[model samples]
Target: MRLTNNLLFFFILILSLYSQPVQAQSCQELETWTRLVEHEFPSVESKSVRSGSLIYNSIRFNLLSDKYFIPVFGKPFEKVGKLKKFSIKVKLTKCKKKPKFPVSKRLDWYMWGVFSQERAYNDAVKEVVLLRQLRNELPSILTKINSPMVTNDDLEDFAKIVETKFQRLLPSEINKLEKAIEKQYTIASKNQLTLAINSLKKEEASFDKLMIISKFKTDNELLLKKLDQDTRHNFFKKLAYLKTKTISELVELEEMLLPNISAVTFQDYAAINTIIDRFTTNWYPYSNLPRVEKLRNYYFELKTLLIAVNHREVIQQIINTNTLQGFKNTQEAIFKYTFSSDQIILDIKSAIVLKYRQLQLLLRIASDEVQSKSYSMATRKKLLNSVKQIQKYERVSIEGKNLINRALHKSQVLCNYIMLEELKKITEPFLSIEKKTIGDLNRLKVKIIDFKNKYKTCDGEVYDGCIKAMEGIEKNYK
Candidate 1:
């Protein structure tokens, strides 16, 4: 009976412990604690992020799927240095009707968390700040570098920054950035070119300036080619204007040198030719410009003047030759030149005629000497040879041929006279023989016959005198 009573008492005590009330959990409490889980996205730092379940206060709590702990682990309390903890309360509740399962126990429980929702929000704020910085800084860099002094390298550096530093931006934003950079670069480059051109304009127009212009042209070939037609013309016009000024000065120098061309030294002649060559080669491309056209006119005029001067020199040389052959050659050479001034040709022809007249006078004086029997046989023969040389000259005018022929005939007559006089002298020695020997008479007759035969074509007075003298010798010998 004592054992039965003790078992009943123990059973009564167990029943009381089993019947204790358990508190029910609320959805609001679950939500408030669940909010502590972080929404961590994938990244380089996220890859190295510590993972797995949490062990806090010696209790193992598995992380829900797709959730992660923050990198710094748990958040701390706002005012205190203690780690922040979130707790959810579970309370027991009776069903309004029948329960699905009998309550086995009763208790009020708590679940704790140390979590936050600020990390994702903070990352978003940083992104917005970075976007603003890129948008503002790129244009700022471009604005700072848009001066006339900016180099291509500076523009290129900005381009490199756009490519490298803005990789995190959206593709659309990156494209806009690239376009902005390109536009700014163009403006900057144009400013630089304009400034350089203005500086060039202030310089004196000289060969040195031309060389610098040529170098500038070569260096900025692409930029210059891309200019609009009017702008291009204006650009080259300034260069052409400078060149025109230089060419005008050169033309003045050439005018100053023109008077000396007749006696120009070899060095001076070469310099003139060099200047002429540059007139053709070193001019700018704005040919339609009025100043350039004026320069071209000056070049042509100078060329014409030089040609006329050279023609005059040639004509003077021909006159100085003092020979009909030289005059004939001058005529032929003149045919090859396209005379810019007809007066030049007319002057040369007139000078040649005057020279011919002078030569004719000289020949007439020699003829007078021959007709008067003033020169020896050798001198007469020399005059005849000179006349014959003139006759043989190629391409003489008909008048010149007639004059040469007349001179030749007069010279021949003179030579014939000298020959006849010498023959008369030879006969005189034989004519002086006192008495007539058969041999002397035979010699005188033979001489007369031979002289008559040799003088068959001769009709001049000297030939008649020679025949009469031989007849006298023949009569004396008889």
Candidate 2:
């Protein structure tokens, strides 16, 4: 009867406390809470449970001063495995209500360095979650920041605000994280450097080939040739354009590295420049030839012949001795032309055409292997040299053709300069014969273009057609 009366009174008291609304604040009394559990609770224990499960319990409190300490229990001991209660004496302080989330700039100042140095395990994990959430949000916030500079001072304030809302990090963990970030940056830098080196090498090769094929080495004799005012102007204008192209290419190759100055060094730039200087020289300008389909067709045939002959030579060498002596002999044969100083330049031009053809064949087969990045450096270099030689021959052959055409054009122009004494002696004006000769030469050029497009060689069909077409053209004037 007495127990029943006491239970009724206790029930009434719990109902009275439960009627009030709970208001969260900096500190609150613990006694105002009503019990949810109907049964007795297990006590905090030091010993291993018979069930082999572990449990932890916590109670929080407000600090006694602006900065203060209170004793709180810590971890358990291993010996005896008995249930034991402990009193841990350590400094414990309250954090500034863990600051309202999505804290403003002003709120950050209020929370700075206000949290204690220690954390309960659960609280530390919550702090880490809070930090990560803020870090994720920072990018957008940083973008919106109105300051001319989001200075280091602004960053420091942000750090303090974040730190005070979380448990303190140990020194060792901070060191490990810094090292990991540094390692990532280092790896990225090295990859960038390697790609740059390879791309630069390829670009250098292209520029080098341009110089090798270019006719910047034109002799004084050609430069000193008497040209009309219009011809002289055209020649100088073309030369200027060629020089501009060379400068543009150099600027482009050097500009590729400007963005990577922090990662690549001056010494690396110097090495690249030295390589560029070595491979390319100057391009010889082509004369403003008339746009004739027959002439262009012949040029295509010339290119075809260059490639086919080179391929045949390579096969022959492989089948022959397959020895270095054979290669030496082949090289000797390519440069075998003998010419006297007073000899026609046409005779000397033939040797270059032969060498160009051989190199063209080598490049046709090897270019794919080089670009695939599967060949040795030495192999790629040899391939590039062949391409350079091919370009040289192309330029040389065109130059030869232009020189012959120019001589023919000059014969017609020279009649205007002939004096009265020489002019009266001739039965016909020299210009008349030269005009007829140019028409005959143009006809021969057309036949040459038509023949080679099908036959693709200067011999056989080319020889027979050429002899038949040109017999009367040269004999009348000679």
> By lDDT, who's the top model here?
1
Clashing pairs in 1: 22-92, 22-107, 23-91, 23-92, 24-91, 24-92
Whole-model Cα lDDT of every candidate shown, in order:
0.52, 0.35
**Candidate 2 structure quality by residue, lDDT tens digits, 1-478:** 9999999997885554344322221112211110111011233222322221212111111111111111111221111111111101100112123333221221212222223222332343354444445445545544433233433334445445434532222223233333433343333333333343334334543445444324432532233243445645654565455545554565455446434432433224334334323322221132222222233333333323333345444434433432345545643443222122323223333443464455444434343333534323344444444444544543333433443344333322332222222223322343345456666556555553554352332234434544444444435444
User: Best by TM-score, which number?
Assistant: 1
Worst 10 residues of 1 by lDDT: 101-110
For residue 396, give model 2's deviation from the true position in Å: 35
Model 1 agreement with the true structure over 345-405: per-residue lDDT tens digits: 5665676666666565555545544464554545555555565556554445555566666
TM-score of each: 0.35, 0.18
